[model samples]
Target: MKATIERATLLKSLSHVQSVVERRNTIPILSNVLIEASADGAIKLMATDLDLQIVESISAQVEQAGATTISAHTLFDIARKLPEGSQVLLHAAEGKMLIQAGRARFNLSTLPRDDFPVIAEGDLPTSFELPAETLKQIIDKTRFAISTEETRYYLNGIYFHVSDEGQPVLKAAATDGHRLARVTVPRPDGADGMPGIIIPRKCIGELRKLLDEVEGSVAVSLSASKIRFGLGSAILTSKLIDGTFPDYSRVIPTGNDKLLKIDPRSFEEGVDRVATIATEKTRAVKMALDRDKITLSVTSPENGTAAEEVSGAFQGEGFEIGFNARYLLDILGQIDSDLVELHLADAAAPTLIRENDRSPALYVLMPMRV
Candidate 1:
């Protein structure tokens, strides 16, 4: 297809779609992006890794109607390096896709568009829409907790399921053996009866990128085996994990009775400083909570020890607990609020963390015995 698209426009569209294409793929076509001209003055850029697919359209001037595929990463690099606001001319000729902009030209090898595997259409059992910001929030907060273990395939994704509370809720949960992150938001009107789906980790990462530019409501459609996220000019579709998510409700502790309110930034900083001396094997930062001061300490036989005291509001009796510093940093970085609340029962009990004054989100971290 011959289409004249602005460099910035093409780059923006490619930036989203090409990320779905793997840089190194055994199948030649899997690393390429399929470009096709629509009837109107819009061009469609599509990419897939077999498991996840992304399609984005950009306004362009179509001179000849056709379709071709080119290396996704190569095209992205070319577009990115081209001059800003430059007009990009693309055409299929001599079994190669020619990209021209300003004083630069590159001929990228082409593949048959038919070879690319597109996510087939399926009857979505349930459909609903939610604000893109909210959708991003759910994914961003809980995605870090997703298990990376390959043996337990079921735990490798964020589980989207309804909560046991009476009201409609959308919950995203992920757990490695070490820590768990569960976030809940009020469900939209039509999403009350939606079935649980475990969205794959790669799909969630791409979905998060798609949601970045989306400001309006994002349309969501899902079936028992697939889920689709549609933004204004972009769409992400993926196959859902078929296995069942474990009963996470039982793992979250409800008996934690101690409460501590502290500045999220200060708390994270203390953890970072104390963790400097933590052993690589443990990476654990120990917390000593007093009446109104919290001391973070870590000791390593090889690196010595470190201790830092941060002011906080604590009402419960003094207690100490060990936690993986990386996990604490991950959760703290995602929390936007200034103050954070932590509920604790004992040194070994799970710690419940919540953004102070915000009820829409809560985090639970299982403590380590030190």
Candidate 2:
């Protein structure tokens, strides 16, 4: 196999595919990326970790059509250190791969391309295309709340499904039992009758990074067991969690009439300042609310107490509530708009938060007892 590609372009494509390669691999072939230089003047880089896979193709001047497997990390590192604007020449023969850029030349061991596990896309019938920005919004807003607990494997991913609320909408929801985030976007035409799927946490992180570099629309296809995202020259495929997501609609509070409208930035800043004195274990902050202002305070047995005040248009009788400082800051950081509303019933009940009730995105946070 022989191909020549620009250093910058090769580095970008390598960065995308190599991330799917696990550093600690039990199988030697899994540590390598399958480089296939086809006759059509392009080279495809593929990497996988059994559960997830990424394939990226870039335009290259291909003189020969062949395939080879070389160390993913080795190739990425070489591409990263190569001079800017340089052309990278890759040639594989006699069980070795040669990388040449400017005056630097390196030879690396190559594995048989046949040894690389290429997951076959059996049949992904349900497919849809959504604008990149909307997909980015849905993912970024909810992924932070994804659970890390492995015992409840089902809760460790974002649950994606189409919801029919007068109009069909695509909803992405994530929770860690303490906090829940649900975001909705207008459903695409082909998404009707699609199966609900839980995209694992790893896939979410990788896909979110890819979406940052994508524009226009992204094609998505899925079956009951797998989901695939096509972002132009890059494709990501992953296995779906087999467990059913819990009915989350019941957890959202409906009767919390106590309302507070405040600048999310200010509230988030206040939480950061007060949390400085909070206990590391609990990381709890207390909020005392009145008609015009909310006092954010924290108490630590080892460290002294800290407090700050932020003004808001809070309705209903004044009440004090406690919540995890980290959780409060996380939800606030996700708010893109200036104004945020909080609906509260009491200190013991779950609080509902959004830009407003009409907003497509909603959050439910379980209050912590400080």
RMSD of each: 1.7, 1.0
What is the model-wide C-alpha lDDT for candidate 2?
0.93
Residue lDDT tens for model 2, 51-97: 99999989999999999999999899999999999999999998998
How many clashes would you count in candidate 2? Answer: 0
What is the number of backbone collisions in each predicted candidate, taken in the order shown? Answer: 0, 0
lDDT of 1 by residue, 1-370 (tens): 7889998899989999888888789999998999999768888899999888888888899998889899999899999999998999999966798889988888878988878788895899788999988888888888898998899999999999876577778888888867778788888867877899999999988888778789989999998899988899998889999899998878677777799999999999989988877777869888999999998998888888899999999988898998889999998888888889898899877888888535666778878776
Q: What are the TM-scores, per candidate, against the unseen true structure?
A: 0.95, 0.98
Misplaced by over 4 Å in model 1 are 356-358
For model 2, the run of ten residues with the poorest summed lDDT? 273-282
lDDT of 1 at 60: 91
TM-score of 1: 0.95
Best of the candidates, lDDT = 2
Give the C-alpha miss distance for residue 142 in model 1, angstroms. Answer: 1.3
Candidate 1: residue 283 lDDT (0-100): 91
Give the backbone clash total of model 1: 0
